[model samples]
Target chain A: MNELVGLSIGSIRQRLVDCQLSTVELVDAYLSHISSQDRALGSFLHVDADGARAAARALDQRIQSGDDLPRLAGTVVAVKDNITVKGLPATAGSRILAGYDPPYDATVVARLRAAGVIIIGKTNLDEFAMGASTEQSAWHPTKNPRDPERVPGGSSGGSAAAVAAGMCTVALGSDTGGSIRQPAAFCGLVGVRPTYGSVSRYGLIAMASSMDVIGPLARSVADARQVLAAIAGYDPDDATTLPHVNLSARAGQTSLTGRRVGVPKEYVAGITDQEVRDSLSATVDRLGAAGAEVIEVSLPTTALAVPTYYVITPAEASSNLARYDGLRFGQPSDRTHGHGAASARLRGQLFGREPKRRITIGTFTLSAGYADRYYHAAQRVRTLIRQDFARVFDQVDLLLTPVAPTPAFPLGSVADPLAMYQQDIFLAAVSLAGLPAAAIPVPTSGQLPVGAQLIGRSGDDNLLLDVAEGLEQALPVSP
Target chain B: MSDTTPTVEHLTKLANLELPTDEQAALAAEFRRIIDFVDALRSAEVGEAQPTSQVTELENVYRADTVEPSVHARTLVETAPHQQGTYFRAPAVFGGQP
Candidate 1:
């Protein structure tokens, strides 16, 4: 509905460069949109309009004075609250951290700011980026812009909501399981969950340390591409970051000719959701029309994805979230009886119902008696999932699958926890494999924004984005 | 996977929450349903697979443990709901009065 909101980030950058749109003006426009519509949409938990305007004005001055401007000068971005932004609240959507402030910027935030992007404020999320829907947020749930009553799938729902509602041109969100891609699919945006090692994890409030990856969710694939290009690359602060790779935007030379896309039989079989299956099938056809080849391939271990992901993520999350014992950072008094009593109190009060449940399950699974039965078994299954992807990559440039079992379910609709876990079936495999996955919406199907997932080879992050961008253009966004 | 004796104290300790007796039956049923769902991995054959703690190959990258200049301690502590001097304050765990 918003023409400017739908503009690709690269094009917007060019418009600003050509003086057609000033940094300050664009920031103000976005601020006006947020003020007008964000309440209903629940897009942002914190909106720093004045701060972003000040930064945007400074960038405008630099450009006006003919200074060498940063790559994303004055482009406004909405940040997930899990990420630290100096002087802004980094709540992670938990009551324990409702007002917790970080003294410094997250490594990614620092990089985005260095690129001259104006960070408007923090978006809502699942408490500590834990749940699939923003419904888990302590603040408010972000509704899907396409259908306001349905959830904008999360834990990055607010990020997707903000982008879809034209509150921010691009936003950052972390994906552990389907956090980024699910929300992106639900909201009809380009959600990129990059190769695990591609982006740094420094200063992101840890959920599952191994599985968490921060990526861009935006209105268009190109906008997602631009945002990824800016904050991706390596950070010395994060041990897991892969060395930087050079990405060239050979504009208009986008040709998918000879790019082989594999349709994994295991991914498609047994899917009962007609709308989701049809959307993926249609997307495959669209990819072919966009000059790509498609073939049916098998990833037999696909069934193990959710099991492996739940095991490994909970195990890792138990370790990652162990830091929030109400002592050093959060509600400090809860754990302050001294030593062991302190840890007990801190752990109980600071961590909410969901976090405690997960940590409990994880610790039990990893306990000495059960490690062989659960934790080690899950690890072995993870290798099988990766091997399945590896074998498929040998046959095709990309592997296509339905991003989830269904389109966005209604907020609070899932009553069973297992059903909630079932939603991550398509997502968990790529995460376990440590490969790249891009979620591009299928235009037909009334634009429920069902994502047709593409899995790229281990380090080929750019190729997936290119394929997504190409498919996006071939099939215009619907609904 | 075996239900022998209910290690009520031990399991409660692992669960971290102080649960009252009335809620235990409900929580147990819920946990059993979850475990049964995840047990689907048993049928998945992963004989030759490697144990993947992390997906990619990354060794620890460490920098010197020098204390770099950080934001003001007072300002960082200021956001906590309850603060005394430099520390955060929260409710007592269980029934232990402090």
Candidate 2:
């Protein structure tokens, strides 16, 4: 069961095609493993054992009948609770949405289902994808699979933890600002923050509308790319999704020859941890050795990213989260008082601390007198930050940097919100630029796994994954 | 550019949220810190840079005017906490019985 659970998507597909593994058996292994292990990890919020078993049985019948199989046949995936999966509770890791089972699947979920991916359950996340750590989840924090005492980096921490611990073959996670990549980095998995609007956000619980993207977390770069290919494309429902976009990496292309890889000086200088800095240097060396030209590039606006992200994200979140008035599909409010009072009381009682704080900050920023100074100023600065990436992309094909300043820290160690926001110092800039970035684990010698981030030009998701795959092969094996 | 600290009461009211009295002071301080942190944007030399609300440069995506089948009203109303014959029930807006 452990060996079957540990198979990659590629191996699983091959074995399934060869009739060596049955879909029901694989799904049962995962369901049983999750049932026993997820208690300690807190990676899953809701397990759809019946749904998974039913899907697996149907797929097994299809395989037995020699019917044409879908691309991701027999692969089991865990979805972040924020992405709706019709009839499944889509909590976004908040108590406010406790009993709200969505009426329909998110666009990505629909696409994944069509491609033959069986969803095992809804994974946990930071409430509304707000915090750097899963500690802010209204239910429970996900422990890092690498070190159970530490948190799995979030808000996609549960997704990362699930994929890392072999609870599922791959997991879907939403990245507003480093939600996917940071968690993947901490959990030692390959996580992609696909180009903004690359994956449809039709049913994803909106965190920050502009920056929100649904991507994949998987054990391998190939698996992440395959999942991205299945979910990415123009969706009429999402006007922002780019038309005629190709998200698939060209097969058999792993060489980094002639690729210009830039090591951002700003990212390197901001790293206070010696181990993480050493890992970055080692990754740069590997990139150079793999026949890529490595250069030091400066993104001066990097320092402004976290501040800009915080401002823009909260502003959008306050507006997006306004819908949870309890009249609709969420925890109902006590109407004994009045409508206005009930609405306020419902939000106050159900919203997690981080969401409330962000709502307050957002409301304050977008208020009449302060909008120009805080909101608009941050937007203009956001433009500058995007320009910084644009300029650097002109000089280099990709930027190599550490995913976070440090690896997974002990749970509850970083208490102050200000210090917590600073974790995205390296991540938020790329997100602000709306470019494709992936976090792939590099070899770590007896230390907590540190991931190296690869940022690509907008719409260059294929190139980013191809390069990450190349680097993944070139980097030394972790002991 | 004056350091005008807005009170939490006013902000939460605008946000349609309420906090317990004991937590208000801590939230106020945290809000101030966040405000001060984002204040760094004021120092950026962003003269004439266009404010980017949406990253995708696409504008005004339009579909065919023909209406398509949408989610059934009954299905949506079923998810509501309170419903009465396909209509979602809500608290009274104007001081009256709901």
Candidate 3:
């Protein structure tokens, strides 16, 4: 492994500040590492090697001029392709938008650039951020760096794999129904899904608008926290961004004494994998040993989360993706036919199997005569799901659950879409309620890493990070 | 709730997607399974609970009405697959020779 690639963001910053390592050298190291390692991993769809080198050179000159460095200076970050980076082909892992390159940067990308972070490349994802595995990606699937046969989880699989394999310091991934956290768990990295409205959604190709949030995947809780802080805050471009949001984690707080952690019984009830069950038990024991009170809590509507999420996400996705007609900035179809026919042909030919399935499902649910039963009912149940979290949060400061039922499953193992949807059973409910959740790797004797999810109340993102940091410190590193 | 499974033809027409004839049957089966799975939402008793379309409670967020400089029309139009001047070029909507 490259020495610079193994260094964390903090150590890299220290090295840069000490004049021991130049930003160009760091970027070159990562670029070379990516070029050599990424062919088999398939983590990146578009690597901006020139762009990254240019940015690093500019930063190195600034350092020589004695300018105050930005908070995340000298860090190389991989963005999931769905989030537009100015002049990069933001494919969203779909053929529909294959050659489309946005002329402007996403709010998060702009912020990361302003923070002196190098835009390394655009990582792959499931088509329109839909599937649990990168197998659904229009491009080749991203393999888990840990065990190449298994998936890295998705739709942020590429981002997770990039960070896991040390291709980048940290990467940004959008989470709607565990896209970020599941991949983090699979890759043995820390992934955060910040509370909805906490981070601006501008420039993100919308999948499920209401539940969509762009967060960070890093090897440490602290790195995730720093990246989240840089990208988070109000943006006029995105009306959903909350004003007066506080993202500061408690300073130097690592002890979990007197903290209240709840284990939702429903989240763990269906775990058939003995390894996952043992991992959860070990996580609970670690939390207890850290002086936190662990109590069993119930979220009865938990089972309804996947159904609700599937309905609502597809419904929103259908509407959001309606903008992808060939007339716009995507693949164009032969225009000998009428406009309507052209649109049908373009979408049919361009969209992958999962996006089409979702669009059809969304149209079905929201169609006349069916909206009352499926779409509206799911919305009402969404309220109940949120209430379940609201009720449980009143008793506990945070909740702990398994990030996924098992460790990363082998690539191509889950074929059925419904079976794949079941993978989010422990994750979708948090998304439905628009809560903040983090997936941290827990020690497991097995070859693959198991992740424990720490779900916090809405806007308590900092608390989640603080506790995760503490637990991360307490737990023995997985060998 | 009606027990009738949605036909793929109806859904494809509604969604404006042209599924290949060979793939429709497989997609139809997948759609049926998904619809059946999501039907579980109907079992939850959501008595008197209002729908939550957006999580953020902020409503009627309005910005100043004053116009701001926007992306250049040419810059925006350049991204389109086909463009005429500053406008996107598309197949005739009225189904006539263009």
Candidate 4:
């Protein structure tokens, strides 16, 4: 069991093909580990032991029958609760969605199942994927496996923590403004936010639809590459998914001989931690040593990304979440009078502080008088942000920047709402630009992990993955 | 935009939220702070630049106008708090007099 839990997907596949490890044994190992160890971590909201056992037994039979196995065969994958699986309780980490079971599987979930991945459980996350930390989840907060006192950076905190703790091989997390990357950075894992519209968002609970992307959080770059390949492609259900989506990650170029990696000047300015700065410098030096030309490039609109994201996200969220009016789903409060009054009471009762705050901000900004001033202005600046990336990509193949201003801080330390929003300062812009970026942990001198993100042009996801693999090899993380 | 800093009452009314006095006061303060923070976008000169509402280049996607079976109406209403004959039940929109 100990050996089974620690093996990578690549290693597991080789063993499974050789009949050294049965699918049932793999599922039982992960389930037992979760049962004994997950109490303190609070990573999983619901562990589907019965369902996992049934699937594993079926896979074992197929393996015995000499049937060809799928790519993700015999691997355990944990999903963020927001992404629905058929008959699984998907609350999107909100009390407002309590007991709401999705009637069908999300496209990604269906894809994962089709590829022979056993979904172990639904994990915890920020309510509606709103907060930077998973502290906002109505259920218990997910603690960082590294240090239980600190937070596993969130809205995808549970998935990151589960992978970090060896509870699952690889987990799927939705990155809407750094939800996946931030937690991966904090937990010392490789997280990728694919090109917007590259992965189908048909089943992902909407949070800023334009920026929300479903991605993989895995312990190694190779595993992330496999998971991305299995799930990324055009889906008929999602019109936003790109038609010519390419799903390949090859390490054809071992050395970064011709790659020109950009280091954004703005990212280094306000980063006060010398340790974080040094870790980033070491990563760049390694890339340079590997023959990649690392140069300082400027994205002048970097500072405006956070504000623009906050404005645009909430504006869309306000419109998207308007459907939850205590009628079709969730429990409604009894406030006398008519439908209008009851919905008002219901939302007021069920919404968490962050959701209410965003709703208010959204309603205020998109108001008749202020719509042009705030919402339109933010969108126009979003255009400028995208232009900034487009112009910089012309000069360099990719940009290397710090994943966050700092590593995982102690949980409950950030109480102020605006301060919490600042956690994504370094990550939100990539989402705004609809670019592909990968976050890999750099071997830092300190105890906590610090990650550097590689940002590539839209549809250059394969290139970024290859680069991430190169960086991972250049500066291998210590266990 | 009001004379004295914007109150949660106005925003709540717009957002269809009902809050007690204390929570409203707290919400009002937080709202003021968030709005102030977002005001930083005013510095960027976005003159004549087109707004990018959607990042994906695809637009006006059309599918065949054919009917496909979907989740039954009963299945949809099964999760609702109150339902009557496969219909989601909600409080009356009009006032009690109706």
iRMSD (1 decimal) for each model: 4.4, 1.1, 1.0, 1.7
Candidate order by DockQ, decreasing, is: 3, 2, 4, 1
List the DockQ of the predictions in order: 0.39, 0.81, 0.82, 0.71
Candidate 2 vs 4: which has more TM-score: 2
Q: List the residue pairs that clash in candidate 3.
A: none
Question: In model 1, how large is the Cα lDDT of residue A466?
Answer: 79
lDDT tens per residue, model 1, A103-209: 88988899889888999999999888888878888777888888898999888999999988888888999998989998888888889898887888888999888
User: Candidate 3: where are CA atoms >4 Å away?
Assistant: A249-252, B1-5
Selected candidate, larger lDDT, 3 vs 4: 3
Alpha-carbon runs more than 4 Å astray in model 4: B1-6
State the lDDT at A420 in candidate 4.
Answer: 96
Tens-place lDDT per residue, model 4, B1-98, is 34554467988888998888888989888888888888899999887889998888898988899988777889889878888989987777888421
lDDT of 4 at A350: 88
Q: Give per-residue CA lDDT, model 1, range B1-98, as digits (tens).
A: 46852343465576455554555555566566666666878887776767888876767767788987666887767666567887765556455564
Residues A192-309 of candidate 4 have per-residue lDDT tens digits of 9999989999989997899999999999988998899888999889999998899784454656877999998998895888878999999989999999999999999999999999
* Candidate 4 chain A lowest-lDDT run of ten: A247-256
Chain A only TM-scores, each candidate in turn:
0.95, 0.98, 0.99, 0.98
Task: Assess the local accuracy of residue A401 in candidate 1 as a C-alpha lDDT between 0 and 100.
Answer: 85
Colliding residue pairs in candidate 2: none
Q: Identify the runs in model 1 with alpha carbons over 4 angstroms from their true place.
A: A1-6, A247-253, A335-350, B5-9, B20-25, B60-98
lDDT of each: 0.79, 0.90, 0.92, 0.90
User: How much is A319 displaced in model 4, in angstroms?
Assistant: 1.2
DockQ measured for candidate 4: 0.71
